[model samples]
Target: MAHTIREKNKLLARVKRIKGQLDAVERALEAEAECEKVMHLLVSARAAMTGLTAEVVEDHVRTHLVDTELFPDALREDGVEELLAVIRTYMK
Candidate 1:
C-alpha cells in the first residue's frame, strides 16, 4: 500500500527488530535454556509481531478507509467493520 511505502523505513525497522527477537528465541532454544527463559523470549517475539500488526492495521484503516475519498461512505463503513471483525478474531 502507498501508506506502507510512505512509512517504509519505519516499518522495516520494526521488522528488523522483530527478526532480532525471533533470532533470540532461536538462540535460546539452541542453547537449551531454561523453559521459563525460552517462554519469555517466545512471548517477546509474539508481542513484537502483534505490535507490528496493529501499527499496519491502524495505518490501513486511516489511509484507505478513513482518509481516502475514493470509497463511498457505505463502503468505508463496511471496510471498517470487516477490519474490526478480523482484529477481534485475532485478539482472541
Candidate 2:
C-alpha cells in the first residue's frame, strides 16, 4: 500500500524508536541488569512492534482493499472479503 510522506515518516519514527529500545535491551543484557527490568523492556518492545504491524496492516487494507470514499458501494464487498481473508491468514 502506498503511504503519504507524513504517514511514512510517522511509521518510520515508530520503527526507529522500537529499534532503539531493542538496542537498549541488548545493552541491558550485556550489563547484567535485573532480569525483571530486561523482561519489561522486552515486553514493551514487542508491544511497539505489534502496534506498528497493526498500523501498517490497517493502512494496507484501507488503500488496497476498502475504498473509504465509496462506503456502501457494491464493489466494496469484494474489498472487504479480500481484507478479511488477509487478516485471517495473518492471524494464523
Off by over 4 Å in 1: 66-92
RMSD of each: 3.8, 4.9
Q: Per-residue lDDT tens digits of candidate 2, residues 1-92? A: 36634488888889899999999999999999999989999999998887777667766665656555675453465766787677756643
For candidate 1, the lDDT comes to: 0.78
Among all candidates shown, the one with the greatest lDDT: 1
TM-score of 2: 0.67
lDDT of 1 at 75: 52
Evaluate residue 33 in candidate 1 and report its C-alpha lDDT on the 0 to 100 scale: 95
Worst 10 residues of 2 by lDDT: 66-75
